[model samples]
Target chain A: MGDPQLSGEQVRQRALLRFDRVERAVHWLNASLFLILVLTGAALYFTPLIALVGRRRLIEQVHLYVGLALPLPLLLGLAGSWGRGLRRDVGRINRWTEADMRWLRGLVDNAAGRRPSAPRPRLGKFNAGQKLNAAFVAGGGLVMLGTGALLRWYVPFPLSWRAGATFVHNWLAFMFVVVILGHIALALSDREALRSMLGGRISSAWAARHAPAWLEEASDQ
Target chain B: MTEHAGPADELPVRGAGAEQPVPSPAGDGTQEPWSKPIGRRTVLSVLGLGALGTLFGSHLQSGISSALNAVHANGIASLLPGGGQFTIYTVTSGYPAAPADYTLRVGGLVQRPLSLPLAELQALPATRLTRNFQCVTGWEVADVHWVGVRLVDLAAHAGVNPAATAFQFRSFDGIYTESLTIQQAHQTGAIVAYSMLGAPVTREHGGPVRLYVPSMFGYKSIKWLSAIDLVARPQPGYWEQNGYPIDAWISGHPPVQAA
Candidate 1:
């Protein structure tokens, strides 16, 4: 569309940087670890899956280790001078402005097939939806880590606490599966967003349309 | 390059100026922790911290375990670790079987040594016990109906010598063995169980007979019952040799923490 003859390097030159290499690396690492955790967790939790994958002890160990490792990527990404992009992005995700509230309302209207009001607010590097997803991943990851650790090495706690942890961990895991599926569906529908996550770049034209506020800010800088 | 906020390369500029020194985000900077050169003192400190952490963890676990010993949170038994079904702990590749000419030996410190066939063992005065079959490692099958000859009746039939103070039980499996105090063996609830779950015990369950010590943990109820040797002193059997308690009583401590 924007000059078909453009080489990969030429396109990359014209593209806006959305995620840096460290951010993308962290994202992919987290995705891979989460996938392993989900598979191993399913094998451990479900009787049919347990029967299908008969090495229960091995699966249990893998689940424990993978779950423990889930937070490592984020922690590593948020560390050192190389983590500047991740740190800034995390800050952006935490702060909600008036434009974000407007974007959230627009999301509801967009879902209902109703056109947004005139002069709709421009979204930042991450839209309200993306910010909410990021918050959930961060908060939910911590909750899961605490509960899972308790379940794995529960000798330090009373039977009652262990039982509560089991309840929280199991239910939260199911919830995570549902939420992650929806996240994947949303990413898939937005080709540019998905591409940006993979290649660390998005077309200027795409950024202007989807994240005009972020594009304007970048231009101002 | 104008389309991007930072430089076109991988690293992004976050501060007011591209040349500005980047501050540490969360004190997780490489300059302090990861990038530091390893020294002997640092290594020793880390090792010492690790040892302290391990000791603290173990002490905390034991303290919690002791404090919660009386806390019978039985309502959530199924959710407890290894709480549900019976997990078979077999050492042999295949279950050992009693020969067609199998005779359970009732000897050693008895007035008269008697070797009786399965039919003869079954014909002895039977006692049916309905009790929870508790495993040492936090599991119990409740209200299991076990039909077999009482150990007291068997001891009476063989005329156990008054000098005898304990019984050493040997499994037909050859490798497996167990022992119980004579007083525990003479409990009304204990039996030489021949039938379980409304059927004759399967080989998986150590048939055609197994001891069911209802008052103690499942490990105390030795399987593949083949011989009973009366002795003067209580002897630790196979599991006891492997650090399992000699008296795995299901009381005072809960079934889940029986071990």
Candidate 2:
């Protein structure tokens, strides 16, 4: 039963809104900040780039300020709209059930494009892979904050502890970069997925193929 | 796929039919847009890029390092602290002067107490040591060549007292002081520095004669010239009194490395 459409104002209303404005804002803001921290942290770890980065003291001061401010964007996102927007997404990212393990089983194949015809399990809001990535990023952020604080001499820890912190900070940051690059590569490969992240709408066909459960749930809401 | 091909279609994620698979694209997945998985080809491609990155990165690094080395060839960075100009860390309003009446008295528990004017101090044979100078506050200046009488040599001239175990070094500024144990005082790089880079050490750099201890942190290298009094025990340095370690290493590494 097709009703007579109001033709003047509406263009196309059929697309799904996969991400709201607040969710996109938080994701991008966190991404950009983390990226800068990663670059500067890498420069510090490497001896070869010291001169290219210039004025070790000045560059280090910049690194310290950015590292300290890392949590501000996330906190603002959570509190800006009284925890309705970003906090909900965070919940979605953190939730895990037994079904997620089944989703995980196919991740390697999915990434490698080995099994194209297999039915993607009903992944709600986020797949198990995304959940794991989110959890890893959250845990990584805490380690960086703690270890960074100690290295910067916020409180007087022993020299040994400072050295230990330095070691952890370097290794964790390297692993983080490798993982983030993989995340970026996957997102860029899937056109609709990247579009959903940007303007928060994805074609229903892409939704059916990848995230059927999420599409069903959104339609009900 | 060729470089000119539409970037997004490099490794098509969804091929046309359900029954048959598409031919995998040859060559490093880096050339292709993202549909390439973490397969053998992809792994090798990343390693290839890493090797190339190392080659390119080292090329850039060497250019910068060599230029830096040329600019700072003769232990000059040390004399010109803070990358060219000296960094002042004095507590007093101004640096103390070495009035021509200036004499460094070596008087504590020594058999021969010698007071030498600056000119007389200059007459002694000079020994130069170029080493990396590091501060406890986490700054470093490399290749500082200091020309001065070794403290051990001076100790030999004055005949150090049998029981004396440490030397308390006083700065001309009076407020700053540091100490070195007998072993540290006799270490290879310990000196009463009077000249830097073939010139008389400037007042900005803690001279008439400042002590240079390459192994210990810069704080122990007490700038400004004055007196050395032998004592029986270790006294906390000015910075040490304010939470700095007695064993500050320039490398920010271990004390053993200083050895």
Candidate 3:
């Protein structure tokens, strides 16, 4: 699919698929739900916010229904044949290789500005940080769902359990805000990565430098 | 003289071995009632029932506390059945119901103390108010139709003494209390409300009777209303003592005409 005038290297520099249509769609849906949950949760939790925007019952219902629907996109995506790319990415996130561990150690050393003991480990579809973020988000989502359910339908729970759920839910939500901000900042700093998320493509040159193993795997496919 | 005619002579003494005509199959007549061995199924059933009862009781207690403790905590009890978008709050762990012989005691500094039943309060002049109910925590139910006797009319009937400058409202829940100045009590929106939304106020919604202070935040309107003691001064209520303002006018301004 290269132009006849273009060299092989120039053709390789052309854009390649990073995320498929279904994966991109799922990611955007999840992001939108997260935004809604955070805003509604803040409106419910903050007295000043409540005073300023005073449709509390409506806001509360929005928060509840949106929270209940948070996991739908991912679950539905995984269920269909169209979700092959998403399912593959999920497997990559779940697996941690020796290279992944070395990448983590190298990351720590790089942040500390120390000299590399060995060459930087090649990355796959996701870096170690990305894997950790995915794991934490998935785990945190489950925790939030369990605790949110308890807080919402509190009658069957004990006082201590409800109290504990509230404590966890509040703290986790604050952590989510911080983490989301960090995620957005990091994504913004890497325009190519952010573009891939938004439009499902990245330059082969960008993929080769960042995820060489993934680039090789894609070429083989 | 009537000892022979008594019904005692016609009955047999059961389980009294010497007086028994026949023994039961399960136990000898000589066995005392307590000595009869219970069946395994019966014991298991009893244990099962006891467990079920304990579980139900615990959930019910938690549910009640969840509904009642909404005032102390943020974002609670809205999902409770029959709460109707209003967060139910109580100082106590449970919702106290009006007693079978419930009466509103109007005393303290009154010239003529009166104990009025629900019927008596309903019998008095009824004022229906359709105004917004605002909670200090910022939830509101608009245009609630309240039906009851006006507090001023009740005070007039009880003959409030000149020394009485305020009204101290007591709740059947026992822990909750609210105070209103004589002027606030005389406001057109203030009433000992028996009905709301065209029906008797529900127990969850502080039924039988509750103070409806439409001009002020909901905390000023006491629930499970059991008494209205004409007092000398406005006393800080349960919420007030817990850092809520005593004069919680909605939107930080008293109503222009109790609307």
True contacts kept of each: 0.00, 0.00, 0.00
Q: State the lDDT of candidate 3 residue by residue for A1-221, as single tens digits.
A: 32212336774677879899999999999999999999988766654455456454567669889999998898888777897677666656555544566688888888999987667766666776886677667667766776777656654554445444554565568777888899999999999899999899998778677876666556655
The residue ranges of model 2 lying beyond 4 angstroms of the native Cα positions read A1-13, A80-82, A108-119, B1-259
Tens digits of per-residue lDDT for model 1, A138-174: 6567667766776566545544454445544654677
Q: Write the per-residue lDDT of candidate 3 for residues B152-213, one digit (tens) a residue.
A: 88998999899989999999976788999888766535889999988999886788899998
Between prediction 1 and prediction 3, the one with superior DockQ is 1
How many collisions per candidate? Answer: 0, 1, 0
lDDT of 1 by residue, B1-259 (tens): 0112122222222211221123445675432211111112232343344333333433443343334443536543322223334445454434566788988899989998989898998888888878877655333555788999888778888898989998899998767789887777655257899999889987767889999987687888888889998889867897677656687775633244211
List where candidate 1 sits over 4 angstroms from the true fold.
A1-13, A109-119, B1-259
Model 2, range B29-122, lDDT digits (tens) per residue? 4222222222223323433443343224324333444554667767643332123222344444445567768898887878999898888887
lDDT by residue for model 2 over A123-205, one digit each (tens)?
55566678667666665666677677766662355433443454355546767888999999999898778988899887655
* Two-chain DockQ for each candidate model: 0.06, 0.05, 0.01
Better of 2 and 3 by DockQ: 2
Best candidate per TM-score, number? 1
Which residue pairs clash in candidate 1? none
Which candidate achieves the best DockQ against the true structure? 1
TM-score of chain B of 2: 0.65
Cα deviation at B43, candidate 3, in Å, is: 45
Docking class of 2: incorrect
